[model samples]
Target: MNTFRQHSKTRSRAVLVAGGAGFLGSTLCERLIADGERVICLDNMQTGTTGNLAALAREPRFSLVEQDVCDPVPRSLEVDAVFNLACAASPPRYQADPVHTMMTCVMGTHHLLDHCAAHGARFVQASTSEVYGDPREHPQREDYWGHVNPIGPRACYDEGKRAAETLCFDYRRGKGGGGAVDVRVARIFNTYGPRMRPDDGRIVSNLICQALADQPLTIYGTGEQTRSFCYVDDMIEGLVRLMRVDPAPDGPVNLGNPGEFTILELAEMVLDLVETTSRVAHEPLPTDDPQRRRPDVSRAETHLGWRPTTPLSAGLPPTIDWFAGLVQHRRADRRAPVAEASALHGVA
Candidate 1:
């Protein structure tokens, strides 16, 4: 059975990180392990690559599961805590396989909740700010009912996650076999980081990739659409704090940086960081994209004593460096010859 040391060796005990090979998941896994916890990473590899878990593989206490969360977890292992981050957060990736995306949230959530029930673990749901849809109010709080269009293309992820949150609460209120079954719901906002996919259409990645490649950064709709960015490290810190909250705050906290910036302003920041001559171009925004999305993190501050600490000016350097490294790796790979590489195997 999974357990924690009473005297404290590292900072955490055993942690189950679902979708641990994706950008956010992998980062969470790394943090958990660094704090002296054994980590079990569950992922299907639909969007996550092995590269995300490579660095963690050498850690004796860390392991990755190549299975989808929709399937039942094996009976042998016990987890002290479960972090359900299996759903896709980016618009393009989730909308690409809408049905599977929904399944991952609905069915995947069921599987994780069941595991939590069996193992007597703390369950943390990686909920999204998208739950608010196009916010009807500024600085969306956890109490806001949201204005999501259930029939829009974006509905698959937005509504699916909303429903998943409901299921979590349902099980918690039912007083199921899961001991305590305390749920930690984090409504995360725009978080950018090192391992993010270069082509996810997320403004940070898009701007960095375009700037590094000296290509024009495409701005969807008016560049005036606003978003608040919390760097990945800050986000992970908030999540961890929420997980370990004493008296176990039955939380649905907004874990995000409240600092707001426009798409165009973010692009300019990227341009300045990468020192690129890349120009900005306007493109039609996809369906149901939120024009203004920022989190109201007062509850997090008042309850969890957590708020983002990383400034965008400071955060962009490392992110730009990461993408720059990836671009260089790709360019070098392309020049190496066809026999040595195959697109089916994926680029670095």
Candidate 2:
């Protein structure tokens, strides 16, 4: 542990979290702070909002930098580690501007690798389950070469992340340095919790929002497609452990809940959690949506000795409350006449 020279309740080593203001990144900052490590949060805010990390800014152990990672990160701030999470994770945002999103994965990751190389810091790439693109095998292991469509809409993010992982290994395998320079590739699954963007269009939030409002919960494709949800807190804990482990594991490791739920099942659970009197409706799932997703946790258990701690029933209520807060707050803003006046006057 790096001794905290100043700021923070307990001593923490200097660290960097690229894209630290987003859902996963913000949670990561929180975990690192609790572990007594000073955190340097970096973000361009293309999709991430500062409001996600606003509370942490007041902490003595935290520092924020609003900048794009595609450009070279400033070389001045020294740090002990880097968590590269700059790319847009959600389908809506990643597909919004395909080129920019791809750059954030490829070019943005390359830039951060440069900084990690210079600083001799532990670097972790926040890889995703999407890399397994419509998997041909169940419970994808680290070695699986996925069934990705290069020309598909998801290719921008899927391939871009694949490219980033390649870079991490190249540096790790090529340098063959002391364990000092570490690299970890985390293949995260569908993680959700508070602080996630309400408009992210993910199933969890979409169902919760509609259910709470008494609208028909849209069940895409008979709701047969399956996916596992990991609470963000559990994910960040796993990631932090992976980052600090020895010998630069050079892993394409899986870090997600092995438990799976069908889309309809998830919506029903959400309705129950929210106590909503809502009906469910069927809709077409978008192109390239994975029909099934379940992580093979054997590697994670073997390597990191970690797995998710929060079950959906336990996790959903708090997650729902967070979305509800955002919804209620936004609704209040809309109901107010001052908000109407400001909106009419083009004030954001």
Model 1: what TM-score?
0.90
On lDDT, the leading prediction is 1
Candidate with the greatest TM-score versus the true structure: 1
Number of clashes recorded per candidate: 0, 1
Q: What is the lDDT of residue 78 in candidate 2?
A: 78
TM-score for each candidate, following the candidate numbering: 0.90, 0.89
The regions of model 1 sitting more than 4 angstroms off are 1-12, 175-180, 331-348
How far residue 92's Cα lies from its native spot in candidate 1, in Å, is: 1.3
Q: Mind giving the per-residue lDDT tens digits that candidate 1 earns over 173-290?
A: 7554555466778898999988888877788898898888789999999899999999999999998888887645564789888999999999888877777889999999888889
Q: All candidates: CA RMSD in angstroms?
A: 4.7, 5.6
